[model samples]
Target: MGKSIRKISWVAFIASIFSFSWALGPSPLVFSSGNQKELWDELLKYKLWGRDALDFNNSNIHFTTVEGYAGTKKDFTLRNGNHIVNGHFVVGESFITDTGPHTFGDGYVRIGGDLVVTENAKNNTTFNDYVCVEGKEANPNNGVFKKGTPTLGSCPGFFPPLENDLDIPVLDLNKLSGTELADFNGGRTEHVNNGVLVIDGLPDNPEESRLKDIYIGELNINNNSTVLIHQNSSNNITRVFVNKFIYSDTEWDIKVSFDGETAIDDSTYAGTLLFYFHNGFTIPAGDRTLHGTYISNGDMILKDHLRMAGQLLSTSITIDADFNSEHFRYVPFDPPLVDPTAFANYILQEGIEGPQLINFELDRPAVIDVDLKYWFEVPTEEDVANYGEGLINANDLASGYPTSETNAKEVFFKKGQSKPTEEQTIVIIDDEFVEEFEILVLCVQIGVGASLPNGTTHQCFDLYIADDDIYLVPEVNEEFDFSVYENSEPKTVVGKVKATHEKNDSLTYAIVDGNELGTFSIDSNGQILVEKKENLDFESDLKQFVLVVEVSTIFNKKATTQVTINVLDVNEKPVFKKGADVVVDENSGEYFEEEWATERFSGSNELNNGKGQNENHPERPGEPQTFKFIVKYTDVR
Candidate 1:
């Protein structure tokens, strides 16, 4: 019941002469081929066809002719296990090792068909005893094909067309101004002048031109320049789309790098970089190294001494350079090309037909019964919107939850059945709005029922019914600066946080952590106001504090941004200390006279002796009594 072992077959062809109809549901697939050539021709009609690696669990495959091929155009990799190919299993030339030549197909490969290597075969790894070539000559140059008994049957024969088409919005370079593009790079909008950006040679400041997920009509790199595509996170992929082409003068001169190093081979120097080209990609002449995946719709021309670690997928390839296999490795996780038209058509058509057919096949034979359980759902509008904004919580979506029931669908095989037909199909119907359906298949031995578990597997696919185009989250403007003088008037308008959504959608604004510190407040109009002026002291508080403002749509979808408020310090008047009573002996006239003279000279004579005659005081004794009087003074300012 392993998810990888499930064999979903598509009707490739029907017997040429005979045909039958089903009274109910869809009709079964039937094929009759006059020769192997006819069978191969029919199979090629499908976008994808053949047996997965898990199909060899209990049986061996036989490759009868050199032309007899099965599998996908995409690269297939075998990690560290012995895989059996009973008959002739012809695959595409792109088959290569995930590790190195010595580690490719580390396990045994037993074949039963007349081993034939096609012109497209291009592997140099040695299979050693791992491959038991039975019929034809097995050479290192052609590939390891050893003669062995056939255990597995022929390939699944037919497979459904891939859902390559998904309607993803493409960026229009002409519509976007240079300032918009620079904003995407987390740079000041004014860095790019006019509507175009040009780098004649190596940038004097590399940080000035760093960007990701942007569209460039034409990019020309000269004079040993470097272009970096930064990965948002370890798992997040960053892509740079070039509408026309990428031009460079020398091979190793114009280097392309990634922010993080390659996970393969534990290399500390190389990073991940992905470039998608609408046209061709010209590899410069000289020794060069590329670490990520390069996808092109047109042909890729490679020059001398090119070393790569990821993958290259194009309409065609032309190699004029020396490929260093030691440094070059294959990466299977490259993103596939999407056809939006096909995706829309598939969704519109399938939406009315309920659930399409899903086939389940066991890798190993067992006398068991299978039960289908609801696994999960996908294309959640909230999740999709959050993912676009880099706020997706993978754990929340992965938590086991039953999305929907099977709704009385027919199961080809039932409980208490022993080794049922391998080609049984199941009809799946779920909720209409659900864009993806995941189901878990549980296999239990006969008489055990559901008490004990034998094997469990799960599969998920997009229903493709969600209307993602219309459900857009608001876009909030980022980074606002609010300057204020220390001890300014209260209730002053600092700045406004602005955001926009669809024309018809209503929005409300609020500060995220507004209540934590009573420094600022925002109204529904996003007008930020100072609440307390006394708290805005430049010396006592930080020079700047960030305010996180969020704008939410009526439907609860929201976007957030940060604002910084700077406080400017101003000079203030000096303060004076209160004076205390001072007692001086009358005999100490010299000291008193000196102090009085100093205070008068300094213009700080705020002291008084009781001898002064005022309206409320009578004249003291003659010549001012020489008594020890108290002197009180305040510091002069």
Candidate 2:
């Protein structure tokens, strides 16, 4: 069904009124309109674009997943009849062309950045009829080709078609750390680099169910791996977020998704699933096929041979294959257009590290369910912007709530047991990494089935969390340096690294750098030793070593320092090769000419150029034969 759009005249008003009356009484009207709702109208008309991609004169402005405004230029191309299909191509920039006979299919082109000829795209015949493929130099031929009135600015970023203030939840993969990313993505930091990832948002029978969101810390798409966006009888959407992107080589075909329903309402899968990457990644060349929209926050590399059945959007796309219909099929996405609503009910919460602290007082002596919501950001700004009002009372707020930056997610938001709960009691954890203080705010919201008399009607209670954990940073002793001659014994501790630590706090040492070749090791006692003794070559180009060590306390407070290890030089007397000069130091050792050491060692009778009797054979790996001689020199000093 085509959408009847709404305007954003009531969003701020809804956001402002979060008192108990609104939660227990009025529900926000479900109409399609907001900063992100414009997407539905534009997509229906084939308009996908970056912000400001159109000519400055266009009235319709759209936003994208990327932040800020990006003006358009001659950035993309339509070669042959590849993208000429039952779809439209919209970009933040304008369409590109060469002087050749390029064939464009039946699809429409809406340039978000710039319009070349601008005369309504030859009455919407093709992209070239409307947008200038050429840059600011002005296509003189545009006057002759263009035929219709000009229109612009049709595409934007991650806005869902339904109401809820474009709230698809813009979770930036680049900004969040691995620990934070895993919290939202199934509470896992590692998954599916080599195995199957089954995201079954829609289950077949009653035994099956739906999934909210899937997250991956770092996803390495490989040929041997399979990613199935499992289908369901209930029409639910599948969403996945990946923090880091990498490529791994394997020897097999990779499965991307199952039958993904093309549009939001449809249960059949013809096309239009999306694989959005925050960082740049690659689709390796193979005898495999993939379906979905490929959008990247950074540059993307498309290898050859993998057939695709969806649209692709990115900052820079490098197609390392033939641009034809057999390789790519342009299918735009159709998101569900409906109203999603929310309301507020209080759920007092504290961290689950110790005993649950926030005690609840029920108004009716009955336990009621409440909704718990969370987002990653500093609590102060987040509180004011999302939940709290202006400078008001602190006593009424979440007790031990952080007004200072010291207790923010940017500083000490650690890992804890954060999960879905319907109980009135909630837990907000303060991690051990928090240095100096531990504090945070846990906001409670009522949505869907929550009601009034269970809580916020005629009476409101002051919520307080009893917390007394003061965190501090761990301290480390100075770096220790020790000198060892070449061929030092492996597994022998050269020196110990000391650190001042609390009696209750345990310290761990790790060699962060200068041990890339697996030449060094550090144990629990901060003992530095050689893992590979052969690496300590005195004559090697590197004469000194600097080991950067990282030390962490039991509380997760960390500090780093360096250890310098210098190699002492060893002098070698010249061997008797014809007329080799043997330096005879009085205190050093006895020096012998070729005549005296003829039968000294067992390997060779004569010092044949100092081969030490083992000329063609090195006794050890790099070591020749051992040279033992008697002292025959007297001190002259």
Candidate with top TM-score is 2
Q: What is the lDDT of residue 374 in candidate 1?
A: 30
Output the TM-score of candidate 2.
Answer: 0.33
Ten residues in sequence with the least summed lDDT for candidate 1: 21-30
TM-score of each: 0.28, 0.33
User: Candidate 1 on 1-637: residue-level lDDT in tens?
Assistant: 1222121211111111121111111001112223433332233222112222211111111211111123432333432222222212233322333222222222233343333333233243334323433344333355532333222323222212221221112234344568645533334221221222322212233343222344455555544544443332212333455555544555432223222222222222122244556666768677666655465556566654455544554444444423344444332221111111222233212223333323332222221233323322333456445433212122223233344444322222332232233432223333323222222232212111111110111223322222232246788777777788876776888888878875446678888863466878888888888887767767664678777888886545778888888888766433323433344533344333324321211223233432322222246532434334344444332
Q: Model 2, residue 351: displacement in angstroms?
A: 68
Tell how far residue 537 is off in model 2, in angstroms.
99
Model 1 residue 379 CA deviation in Å:
48
- Give the residue spans of candidate 1 off by over 4 A: 1-144, 147-153, 156-211, 230-236, 246-249, 253-266, 269-272, 331-637
Best lDDT among the predictions, by candidate number: 2
Q: RMSD in angstroms, candidate 1? A: 27.3
Which window of 10 residues has the lowest lDDT sum in candidate 2? 21-30
